[model samples]
Target: MRSKRIVILTEGHTNPITAKTAWAVLRYRGGDVVALFDTTQAGKTAGELMNVGGDIPIIGSLDEVAEPDALLIGIAPMGGKLPTEWKSIIVSAIERGMTIISGLHDFLSNDKDLVAAAEQHGVELVDIRKNNERDVSNRLDLREDCLRIHTVGHDCSIGKMVTSVELTNELKRQGQDAKFVATGQTGIMIEGDGCPVDCVVSDFVNGSIEKQILANQHHDILVIEGQASLAHPRYSAVTAGLLHGCLPHGMILVFEAGRKTVSGMPHIPLTPLPKLIQAYENLAALHMPSKVIGLAMNGRLLTPEQAEDERKRVQDETGLVVCDVFRDGSEPLAAAVMNLRAEIFGTPVAS
Candidate 1:
């Protein structure tokens, strides 16, 4: 059977957080992308603008697609609320016999108009975030066979997902069986499976992650994609819950270069990289003999000189291998993880 054709809708917002959901589809599910709908980035091809979309068209609206099997609501808005403007577009897609898939807190399946339109058109409405509370039966304990490398970050949007994906691919390239366990809405969208911890209620978030870890037990290494920072007030519960939920063997600390405060909140200053890394290590040590093995920095917004300087500074501070995953690739970071693997499992990750 053929994969369903999907078109991501980004609309006017293209900031990293909002665009991240579409980024996952582009990076991991590009084969299914029929087109992208982001008027802000309409003219450029998906590959030119996104992390991973190869030569796909970017249209202004759903009117451009003759037909699509599904329309993925591709923005994790400020509050995960579906934009008021998006309702009309969603209804139109449903009317056109397109199933709607969303990972938003505002459950599209529960919205009366959306449900009615989907039923009327004989299409399906899938809210990946909603209706999954029962699947989490238990918070299983960590596995002894699989080495879980949880990617924690200094702040939200600090390259956790990108680093996790890149490192997993790098390990696979070296013939080390690696798996990515996604935890966010975008990661779930990209992997086609994962527990959206932010959407999961507090009591069940850990149970949900525990369930994912138990299900994916085939790989040698599990590169679990991390979530919000423990420093982030609004989302610290999720960050801490996911961090402890997976019960990592080690961690890769990710940080954005030049970010002084938690993304938008300037009132709270960011702790130094060494301090933040130590905090995660201390937290993980509570459950296991875990420490941060490497560093991943998002240096895209920084100048080359600034990026290099920060990398060197962080290396000095943490005494760990640091790599700019986007500009320099994940080899340095991957090597660090591989070294840890060798120490634990007595194996080399190379040809």
Candidate 2:
């Protein structure tokens, strides 16, 4: 498939958390992103704003973009609803013959005005969060020959998807036939194929993820992109579904350094790393024996020295291989995953 010259619509919120869709797209698909539309951050480069997309122009309006092929709704706000204020911008882009790509729970295809405009311009409205899978969990056995590694997080947006992607890439770099099974909209966008398990029906979440696992069992390893944390108060169901569904042989625990509370909910204290690890392992053991093989720390908020210190401290405390996958690299974590594969299969991965 040909890459589209895309422009992201992040408007007022261009920070890393709120504009995470933009950040992931920039991090993984920066080559295709022509510009970012953030009025407040206009005239600044994406690198200056979020330190990812190097020198990608941040423009104030669609007019600033020169015949871009698509406009991605680059913010997944709370409730995943489309912002009413951005309706005009979306309509304008559709009129200009740009495909509209959205990852929000609110489907742009259902919006009458946007649909009309897209039809008039002969463009597509791609809602990445839309799910069509209806299969229930068959509880069928997964391939024992293929190792499945799932990324479980301590909190939401703590870098589970990033860690999974990096690990998949690193495993492939080491000559393992690895595949990343994306379970969220951002991951689906980046991988170009995945079931947005979070959007699936409550009863179908397991089936949805199991479907992904079954399809990708051909690979030597599957790095499944995780959703909310198992410790999350509100969103733990999705995490539970992922755990039971994937039945991973090994897991990577992702946590942000110095995070004391649940993300976005300050009143709730976070579960300790040891307890969280135990919780994940216990839950996974219900279906199959799985242990967290390593830790991926999100140290974006910390200085390099602090991050290194935290890595050493966490490793010493948990007795697991630790890495800030983004700050450092996926080498340590990838090696840990490969080691788990070797231990389980009693064979070394071919290079």
Candidate 3:
């Protein structure tokens, strides 16, 4: 994939977090962001709104923007229905020769009008979450030949995917053959591969993960992107399926540092890090043995001093490596993963 110049369409959406598609592209692939199309947030910059990417202009519509390689619809609305208003914009982008990249479960490619428009204009529509409803027939045979790490989180959108992507990038920097297995729509869009576990039926959820891991058997380290929280009542089934399917040898528990309660389920308070990791490890034990190497703390909301203090506190309490995957990078976590490889497989990270 060559460097893509893209504009994100978060039109009619408000919250930045639920704007999952936009946030992932901005946080992980900020360099590609040429502009943001959000009528409500028009005229502002992504820096002012999201506070990460620096001053990417926010436009009122696709008409206001120039040519872009892609137009990304990054909103994952509940029920996954494409808004009627966005439909015209999709057609307009296609007519202008920009490929449409959407992460919605309601695949834009399936829309007859959108399809015709793209074909007429010689553009493409890339739908990440489409065709995930098929059954994965492979038997559940968890592999142990390579080093595997699953990024579990305290809640949905708690930086699990970010941890996996960042760790994979960090390991590759050290010249290791690390493969990232994306497990959700955002991860799929980022990697251009992997499954959306939530879109699969409960019966095939584990199979979905198994298929991804088995395909990457040649890699030295398989950093699988995890989804949801074991503590989240609503989506824990998906989480459990991922754990059983991948059967990771070690774990990196992801969390937003200093969070008081789990997102969405505010009634259920955040679990203590040690207990949470214990629960995750116990679940992982049901399939194959695993241990948590460290914490991938999302310290974006914390002050630098507060983040350092919290990182020190977490390490002191848990006796495991803790790193701000964004700020601190994944060096400590990568080193811990290598150490785990030696402990479990009696080998270094492929030398």
TM-scores of all predicted structures? 0.92, 0.97, 0.89
Tens digits of lDDT, candidate 1, 1-351: 233689888787644455788877777778888988877777777777665676788887777776688888877776788989888888878888888888889899879999988888999888877745555445345566788889998988778988998899999898888999988777877776787888888887777788888888677899999888877877888888888778888899888888888777889898787778878878877877898888898897799999999899988888888889889999987888877878888875445
Give the CA lDDT, 0 to 100, for residue 233 in model 3.
75
Instruction: Count clashing pairs, candidate 3.
Output: 0
Better of 2 and 3 by TM-score: 2
The candidate 3 region of ten consecutive residues with least summed lDDT is 133-142
- Model 2 agreement with the true structure over 1-351: per-residue lDDT tens digits: 434799999999887788999999999989999999988889999998878998999998888877798999999887899989899989888888888899999999889998888888998999998877788889777787989999999999889999999999998888889999999989988999989888998998999999999999999899999899998998999999989989899999999999999988999999999999999999999878999999999998899999999999999999999999887889998888877877988867354
> Model 2: clashing residue pairs?
none
Off by over 4 Å in 3: 1-3, 12-16, 109-123, 132-144
Predictions in order: lDDT: 0.81, 0.90, 0.83
The sequence of per-residue lDDT tens digits that candidate 3 reaches over residues 1-351 is 443889888887634676867888887788887888888889988878776667888888776766677888878876678889888877777877898888787877778988888889998888777665555646445456688899998887778988899999999999988999998888877787898888788888887788888888688799999888898877899999989888888999998887888777678888788888899999888767899889999897899999999999999999998999888789999999888888887875345
Error of 3 at 265 (Å): 2.5
lDDT of 1 at 180: 92
Q: Is candidate 2 or candidate 3 better by lDDT?
A: 2
Angstrom error at residue 10, model 1: 1.2
